[model samples]
Target: MNPTIKDVAKLANTSKSTVSRYLNGSPVKKETEEALKKAIKELNYHRNENARRLVRSKTQTIGIVVDSITNIFYPSIFRGIEEVAKEKGFNCVFYSMTSNKYKESYFQNLFFEGHVDGIIMISFSKRDKQELVEIAEAGFPAVVFGDSAGIPNIISVDVDNYYGIAELVRYLHRIGHEKIAYISGPEDAAATKCRLAGYLETIGQLGLKVNPSWIVTTDWSNEGGYHAMNQLLADGDFTAVVASNDETAIGALRAFQERGYHVPTNFSITGFDDITLASWVYPSLTTVKQPFMQMGMKAATELFRRMEHGEEYPSERHLLKPELIIRDSCRKISEPIATLK
Candidate 1:
């Protein structure tokens, strides 16, 4: 027996009208939305899309949900999505959630309500992933523009985080760096886990000893990078730091400069995500370039195909390549670098 809206309403302790408002993309209170989402998940409750689509019809619009608009990486990706949208004669409504879970729920509600024929999402959390999987399982047309490691149901278009980090590590080794440290993003992120695995695997292959203290954990923020670098300074010594992204790398650079360390002379740093700031910063950042625009294009293309072909359409997982952008951040060192015992 399939769950009904009444079951959802009952489990959430909210009125049927409130649940209707939520499903219809009407604004609901934050706590109410949370409760509804929880109830929906627990009960595996999905709205009657077939009946809804009979009334709404095709809108020829696709929704895009990005993690952050201000982050330099997304605009290029947006451009890519836009390009595909134009070619396919579709319109796009871009939404930036900015890490707010409730806001994400609001957008998901819009997606569920048949407002858009399809949707492309970027930077999903574990909770977001589960919800998205459920959404896809319900036969919604969707694409994720980030890691989709554990979930096979949802279509994903992502850069190769592991290969990118491996190339970065190999590049550092080639530049005569033996003692290296890594500043990682949140542990739960698939990108963080994959990049960390690459770093560990490559270093092991090269016979380099890893000091556990050298691997500092932080969020993917400049301030987090700055503080993590300071912690590294207090904890031990290393020749180079592999940052999770260009922002953190730049932040770490500032930290080292504040302590009067000359980049590449006394220390070296590298970053992933070759954002615009990477090249503009002093002693320009050596980083890995993720094909942001291509990822967007691929995601949008996959989404439209699924929308047109329905449930029988084959799912896809596109792993785009990452490029190593060499710059002035690193240097060849003759002396052996120090390490914490």
Candidate 2:
């Protein structure tokens, strides 16, 4: 028989648990790491794939399907996931899919085909989410960070998108912006639904009128924001803008300058997701800050609990709150003097 983990631990003068932890990807002291490495080399001890499969019901790895790296929110969330996974001795495997077609199939093949022990999908589109429900209904552990179909085996973590956008629109209204141009993400996205609902609902609540021409939907990207802004300008007559995200806001800011409209002075603009770029622009952005990394960490924690307890793992849904960051890009205008001189 080959030397098992016990033999290696004994040679390294360490407890079996320490060896196990190290093997599972947990952090170990430098001295212990060196000792274990030396002992494993000397004993020629290697993990038995067949035995591991027979006795242990885990791969000790996690799979995270995230949105495109271009989205500023995904990186923050990825860090939170990686941190928790490391503590639990589980390594992470990440796959990024931006569009509808890419998200569904890439994650399906990765999860059902036995590549990872569990999976977490972040910021996925709405229509593609039904596939996740099916996977969870089959008794597999699946977690979604943004929007999900709310199945039993799936843990859903959602940001308070509805109220967050509603408050932003109310703020724009409070500052005397009656005519607002709205830049939207792709219509199929769950976020688009939530954000748009907030905008429309809040506009009605405030008794404000919205022109149909002022709404333009596009991909959630910087270039998408740019194009959307140009289209809005062609047919729009508004004093304020509510962009879908920071990238979109940044692009719209540029469009404003190219058209000789100074931000906050001529047009007060607000965006969602207070990304790093939100502050670095010439005039800082006024936007909502979603807890991206915290959400990721929470999802990972939930995954670990389910992995250990299976049926006993409590299926919980978390809704994180969003914060409003006041900056120079959005300005207050008097009701009587809404237009810039």
Candidate 3:
């Protein structure tokens, strides 16, 4: 038998009304929030949706959770989800993550409180992933996307991160870049891990020497990439750097220019996620294109289907492939591979 709200209340040492208010979207004290979270995590508790719907009700809206609404990659994806929701006669409510610690309670309020019928969580944190998985397993409707959710027993849509970056690394190899560094996105993100793994694995396969100092982890921000690249310039010498995203690549270019190192001349570069700025940049970024809009459309379409057909649907996992766009950022070296080594 699964844990009940009483267990949550007992373990949290809070009244049932407090837990109810917290779960039903009502604002609660931070101390109460922390207590509830600890108790829930300790007991592996999941609120039953059937019980939730018996008293409360849905508002015919789909809530979307995003890490950053201003991020370039999410606009097209949002369009796709909204377009599908519009066709299906449902409204969309977007929730930009404000505080990391309060997210679970906020989601409980957003979901268990009945403000939205279901939720689509884009770019989940590790804690977020576990909570969402528990929510789904407890019979709530959820669709995970953007990064690795790692809940094969649940519904999710994402790109093939390893394949995407591996292709980029291979392309650099084809163009004769031997010494390459990796600029990672947010350290906690699943995409960053996969891309880093791809770079390490492919370089090893090609017999390239790995420099421990060449790898840098950073937040997925333009400034973060700029500073990381600047540090790399101040320290190591490499032929190229593989940025985890287009924004980082763009910033790295700025850093390269500031130091009088011309792109494709002194330092070649690559990135993932073909944002609009990728093409507008000087030399145009040679990056991997993820199917963001298609991914959003598929996630929303499947989510609506689950709403109508049944929530007991088999977990749907969509791993879309990324396309590598070749451009002028990289140049072929005249020296033999052995000589470069």
Per-model lDDT: 0.81, 0.79, 0.79
Model 1, runs deviating above 4 Å: 1-56, 96-113, 188-190, 335-341
Provide TM-scores for the models: 0.77, 0.73, 0.75
**Which segments of model 2 are wrong by more than 4 Å?**
1-55, 67-71, 95-115, 127-130, 150-153, 335-341
Report the lDDT of model 3 for residue 207. 91
Q: Can you list the residue pairs that collide in candidate 2?
A: none
Q: Where is model 2 poorest over a 10-residue stretch in terms of lDDT?
A: 50-59
Residue-level lDDT of model 2, residues 114-217, one tens digit each, is 57878887775564556765555434556778777655556788787777788789999888889987888887678888898888888889999979998899
After best superposition, candidate 1 residue 108: deviation in angstroms? Answer: 6.0
Report lDDT (Cα) of residue 118, candidate 1.
77
Q: Itemize residue pairs with steric clashes in candidate 1.
A: none
Error of 3 at 149 (Å): 4.4
Writing each residue's lDDT as its tens digit, candidate 1 over 1-341 gives 99988899899997664576567555555777899999999999877867455344567899998776666677888899999999989999977777556454466556556588778877734335566555555445678888665677668888888899999989999988898999998865668888899899999999998999999999888999999999999997788889988888999999999998878778989999998899999899999999888888889889888776654567778899899999999987875544424
Winner of 1 and 2 under lDDT: 1
Worst 10 residues of 3 by lDDT: 332-341
